[model samples]
Target: MREKLGKISNFLVSLAAGIASFVFTLVAVLVVTDFNEKLAASLIMGLFALLIVWVASEQPNSSQARAVSALIKRLLAVGSGDLTSPTPAAVRREMPALAAAVDNLFEQVRSNLDNVHAIALYDPVTSLPNRVHFKREADRVLKARGWDDGVALLFIDLDGFKEVNDSLGHAQGDQVLTMVANRLRIVVKAETREDSLAPPLLARLAGDEFTLLFPRVREPAEAERIAQSALVALCEPFEVGEQTIDMGASIGVALSPRHGTDLAALMKAADIAMYHAKESGRSQASMFHARMAAAFEEKVQTEKALREALGRSEFELAYQPQLDARSGVVVAGEALIRWNHPYDGLRLPDSFIGIAEESSLIVDIGDWVIDGVAATAARWHARGMAQRLTFNVSPKQIERADFFDRLRAAVERHQAPLRMLELEITETLVMKCGDRVIAELAALRAEGLSIAIDDFGSGYSNLARLKDMPLDRVKLDRSLTADVDRSEGALAIVTAVIHLIHGVGCEVVGEGVERREQLDLLRAVGCDVVQGFAFSEALAETEFLDWVRDNAPLRLLPRSA
Candidate 1:
């Protein structure tokens, strides 16, 4: 207490002495000058006022106060992005507690900044750069490369990822994604290091999409080699939990100056090329070309048109007769979708169905078809028509958890023609469907909705899986019967398939029986039903009903007549 009082007393005395000296000096200066009497008086008064204000407001009373003032000035440097400035030693020595607190505050700020940066620029799940970070780095690399050097961008998309998610669940899907990112990093790192090239920038763009930037590659072959390595790395199965998942990637390569020198253009080209690789059969790489952009634009336009198609009511259904092999009576009419495009005239499903599925428009389109077919069946049943009506189902439609509910509602809304409605799905879909989907199909079947396998022999013929499904009929693919009348091998295979299907307690329907010989062959092989041009091409609703009424006893006769 005495020491503090003595210090304060001494400070006051010194301050008084300093003030007295400043006054004396100013008076001495005015006397020495003896010039400009009014100016000298004004200067003395101003000097005295400044001294008083300095002592009262600005001057620090002790070393601790001075240190704190200096420390605050230094800390405020943070506003200018100068977080790394060191604290003065004198300040540290004078007030260690405040110095330590400031240091801790700076540390917390830095840690928080790092976290924000990671969240902004890195994918949390894979810890790879996110889309924003990828684009920033890619732009930097492209700019640094200039016109002399060439760079390549690889846009990679995973194949069969949706199936993995649908069948195994999203948790397993995330595991697969993380493993994929790690494998890609390893492969890319290894290749770049082995070749002693500049390290490539890799990032997860979004779900199942990743990007790799090669900053120093000039040759397409080099990029191709890297893409192949990445593909081969992904070819190794990812073992997640009890499941060993086999996944593949399609990589698209776009070179700077060739595709485009900018980030947006390069990315667009690479994305288009990647889709081409995927469409041309996955597990490969495709280089960007001008033609791909055109096709991509066309597809974009088509997708846009398709989106408005349902709202515009531009879609309609045509029915083709499915006949009993012995009677040739129209047992069912396969409902096929037609787009009465205003500008393009009548368009087949082939013109837009692929786009519809890719853009997820199939779900809505599928719903529309279901409603249309149900209404048609109800109308036909009201008119005393006994034949069933069938329509194809898309995999995307079945992927929905509420597919059964929606379908049942549609049927009931149309007075419940569950007995006259048959749903056809591809054989591959039937085989690949998850247990939940299979159960739903069984539930629908139990509700008296017949399930038929469409294009049965088109893909992997897993008859065992087929038997496990609650299916009532299997329709042979057109390919299977394309030459069944001429080729003994085809006939034998068809006969075996029919018998196998029959063995599973499912009736066999032969598709594309356009010739009498084919019909005769199918019938001889014990095929229960046939449908093709041999009966009639798909007809409009009214035409179909008229044909059905006129040819109710339509006999199994050759089209040659």
Candidate 2:
């Protein structure tokens, strides 16, 4: 009886201790943990209860009792976060199902933790290390190296990615981004040194932007070589699904100690250099320089001013006369935009147009131009001037879904005749816009507006497709006409181009004519219209009207005489 009582007392004591532990762990887990953790806690409590029952039913020194005791000790260790503790083989043999369940629970918890860690550190779309991880890893490597050797950082930004997303769906865009990340990884991996203390690191900073870090770079030439490799890798066409997409990357290279010493500084330098690469042209790399920073500052200020210019009514138009080559008579004028900036004096399109185009501010500016030109054309028509006026169009303006409606509204609002106005589109824009643009242009033509291909011969265009366009005329770029008077080669090209335009039922306008020899050669080649400084430079609204009246004598003279 004494022995039985002692065994019973010892079992009660063990059961009480196990119950207290279960209660404490259960309270904590229920209060602060997730469903999985609560479930784990409940299973542990059940295990302890089973052990208590086993101890009460078994002999004082049985194998069951020993296994229960060992499992209780292991469970205690596990509850305190020591996952390395394992259920004894005796416990597994005695309670195979329960021991397997516990082991599976622990394995699942570990796998869940790994998944959470990856979600926090990597980009979900491309599976590349994100900005947070990139910064952390870059800082660690930079500190470990002690700044003994130079490091090169490249900031990569994709060009024309937005257009891809706009044309194709976001799903396709994600595929492009994934392919881009994989290619970048391959390029960096190929350049990685096998024995270097710090290998190259690559990360996706954000949408359409990535970074590459090269450690232990000894020369700028080495950095340049890697940058070129990256450019070439990205320049190749990416095949996504059934469609082939052409892409390009602009890279900015920044060297340690020269451009910056820390991650933030290096990022800023590399970013600025990348902007320079984009400005020079995409699909290239640019090195960090102090002047680039200054230029970037200027560009920012100019963009801000341009955005505000429309609101301030600081914009005006100047017209350069286009005369009939056969009659030597002023027949039309091309409208050019000018900004009368308050702080910078007068600024031409070359000084700020590219900046406007980049920010998409040109859309608003183009609207303003269209309204202003329509109003002016109305006034001209009211005064009996039937001569047509041409205005350049931007790709952004054409891309808007409501472009046609907005244009027609502007003309209707000004009560202007469509025949008195013409639209000029560049050759490159025409090619890029494809069939939709052709259909739109035909619709616009049906509405009585004339369409002209501007800057001809300056860009690539399929001659076979030229006949399909709704064009009234084709303007010869100054590049082709500048040397026509001096070079037979240039003159021959011009003559052939004129005949081609004629074949397509379109007249040819030779621009930038600054000399009699050039004019005579153009006239001899069957050019229809001429415009440049030789006749008149771009003039203000009032100056143009005055010059027109002043040059009435030259209007009737035949150039063929």
Candidate 3:
């Protein structure tokens, strides 16, 4: 009540000052119009008296102006961030409604900023804190730990997610991703203790990729346990609409101080580890180790060397003789690519083929392989060794837009006999290279070339898919042929494979038959051909020809199909 009375008193004082000024102006005007000395003197005296009265009245209201100044100061303070302090009641009394409105506006602005920060820091889909929040938390916590407390980052990528997206449609794929996100959150929560300092934070980094961070990790086992729990939980089939889907995760774990003290370094190490997991087999996890770093460097070197090797003509094929089981004669040869690196002696296909296939180098390397083998076959044909020459074909090579054209060109350039140039494709190529590959292979077969299923029993055994393929032969994979001599189970598998191959109108070739006993077992199973070290290891063209010349009746003399 006093505050309102003070405002009313100030208003009345201001009104009195205005009235005093108006009376002084009127008296002066009257004195000027009269133009008399006595009248002017009287008017000046009255004006002076009125001015004195106005000054006296205004002096008592000085505190009101001071109060207004203080109110302005308080508003400036609010603008400059003295947020907790409220405007004084005396100053607010000068303008109560305006003061209250300003305070409310400030609060609304602060709230909007907080909400904006949350929107910027969290993922809309999962409602989980996002990469920005993760990095911020990781950086601050890791620095605070100071290499004393442990920190771990788990980088996870979904396996076969692309297939799921492509086959089941993206809506279903998103449902799977959301299901995975929920599963990850639940598992991480269960692993963390109620009073844990810096519990595990699970964030979806991007589509089908997530990173789980454990601050004050304490030990590697904890991270691994969390990883195992998350993976096991994630893989459980998710039901969306009418369908149930199975999923798998590849996890890469990296620890602080050991891997690195920062989020970027830890993430990189974890990514590399995750890649290793995928390479070993998806649905598994690998911890960051020094050896994995070395392996990564080696792979980089191999990629560089492979690119150089192709141009330097450092790659060569070693022909492994495949024999006719019935005749015991070397009827054909499989061309295996070997890289004789100038720095590192000989590198087998297993050592570098994966690297090549992953990079753009595969296309060039594959082209060279096809060309070199075709040229070699031409030479063998000229030497009266008309044995068919088969070469392993990478799926990438076969899936190329110009694969058929390139193969045709290579054969024509070398004058290779189409019937004698066989291409060996893996089971993955047969089953998973999409219909494009199948259609292309069918076209290639129509051109009078033979296509064989290489590493047969080792890959997806889909008979329906195989029936559609134009396969000339099924080379029993090395795994099934390794111990067929002693293991009844092994022999039984080989027998069944041979029967299956024959049923599909394709011949069976036993691979890696290192013993005569294995060979006898394969022959008993009606294997049509065999390729192994037992007969002859892979050799250079000169050595291979020499081997053929020395062995009687094994030489590929001019023979008709």
Candidate 4:
């Protein structure tokens, strides 16, 4: 009784002492404080005495202490990610409020982690798994794949998406993207329902680039069918807020265990195929092959070398002169670029022009050509060897927003007379370019730059449209003039084209006139200018200048004019 009640007796004594101390504190604080301060102090002292008694009674082995220890262990376990472990009832009953707070905190942390993961792994706009997640899923599928399992990846790039974004605002572009995503989802989901195959994994790899993975397909054709379905779905024009937009997709397909066994290889193959499809004209699909990757790698190497070539000044112009059929003299010269490659000897325009055009290196390349041609032609003008210098202009350069501005700047910088510089565009470019492009060309023509439709019969010929275009010359493609002497039908076609071009007040030029009979036919058909291997091939600058000196009275137009 003495030992047990001793704790209570000590607590009573401590309570008495605390009361006296509280009174002293109130007296001291009352001097500088209010009645509320004294009342709070007395109550705090009483609670302190009871806390001491409770602390003394609850030893390390007491139920309260045991409950606290159990709670600590549970908290440590929770911190260690053992959320499934049960919370002890002793801890909860002893400290219900604290237990409740800990449980809520645990859930909150878990929720935050999940939300962070979702944000990191998902595209918010399309609500599709991102590239990282897609690659992870691909790896998982590949690992679990059976011996005969074939997985296919389709890399889909939206054709003309940049155009839409440029013409319409970004808001409109976003709407278009969301709609496209929805269409893809619907098409893939619908196909999955019909076939008992596992659902296709769709992901938005990046802006305007989406990917579809068939992880459990038995054959590559199944992947292609899904691509077809998606393309068909996109074929229908999308409507956004009273405006209808036309969009197309280019797809590249790669099969697993054939094209590649991993995500990187498969994506690479598909990417190459997709790029090829885009180049071959959009709204198409292509399959990945080993050769495709090899070709792509080669192209990349070539592009890099081309950039170095530009920097090293390894390029030069080879001139091929045009002759007057009546006078039998060289009249004007066409400036053709040649790359004097260090190891590959001389590289022709055909070897690299397509690559340049595709990569938009043409813009820089065209600038280089313009500067070089303008400077060279300026020198020729000073030497009385002046003739209208014709140089091919890429279609992309014509469409560039800064083309005219840059052209005018280059001409001024080189002090080359615009009248002496002739820009030749392919018929394919002129026919497809917007009216705005024609308007730009007219502005260039206004500056006295002559425009010729090069390779006139190559395609996209609208005779009526040609009349409206500002033109000074029409170069009939070599195909129309190749067998002019061998076939009367060819001569008739050439004669008709010449007559039609003459009617449009444009001079007619025949290309690829190698045979004397071809020249005779061209003269008979009233063709004004002829260029081919018959008279002279494209020559180096020195060779051309010497040839110009050798052939006197070959000037087509006066330099001052």
Top TM-score prediction, candidate number: 1
How high is the CA lDDT of each candidate model?
A: 0.87, 0.88, 0.83, 0.83
User: Tell me, what's the RMSD of every candidate?
Assistant: 8.3, 11.8, 7.5, 7.9
Write the number of the candidate with greater TM-score, choosing between 2 and 3: 2
Task: Give the clashing residue pairs of candidate 3, or none.
Answer: none
lDDT of 4: 0.83
Query: Could you estimate the TM-score for every candidate?
Result: 0.87, 0.79, 0.73, 0.73
Candidate 3 lDDT over 383-450, as tens digits, reads: 77778899988877887788888988999999988878899998976877677677777887888788
Task: Report the lDDT tens digits of candidate 2 across residue range 66-146.
Answer: 678788888788668787666688789878887898888778887887899899899999999999999999998777775
> Candidate 3 regions off by >4 Å?
1-133, 169-171, 192-199, 240-242, 358-360, 378-385, 399-402, 412-415, 549-552, 555-561
Per-residue accuracy of model 4 over 1-561 as CA lDDT, tens digit each:
434565576567667766766676666565636688777766876776677566555534345566788988887886677875666787787778877887787788778988899988998887889988988887887777787878888899998787678667799898898898899889767766444245668899999999988766657677788888888887689888888888889999988888888888888899999998887888988988777778899889889889999999998998998987777677788999999888899999988888998887888888888888899878888887657889998878878888888888888888888888899999977766777878888888998889999998877688887889999999999999999999989899999999999999999889988987888888888899989988789998889989878876544322220
**Per-residue CA lDDT of candidate 1, range 429-502, in tens?**
88788889888888888978899999988888888887799999999999999999899999999999999999
- List residue ranges in candidate 1 displaced over 4 A: 1-61, 87-91, 193-198, 556-561
Clashes found in each candidate (C-alpha, N, C closer than 3 A): 0, 0, 0, 0
Candidate 3: Cα lDDT at 322: 86
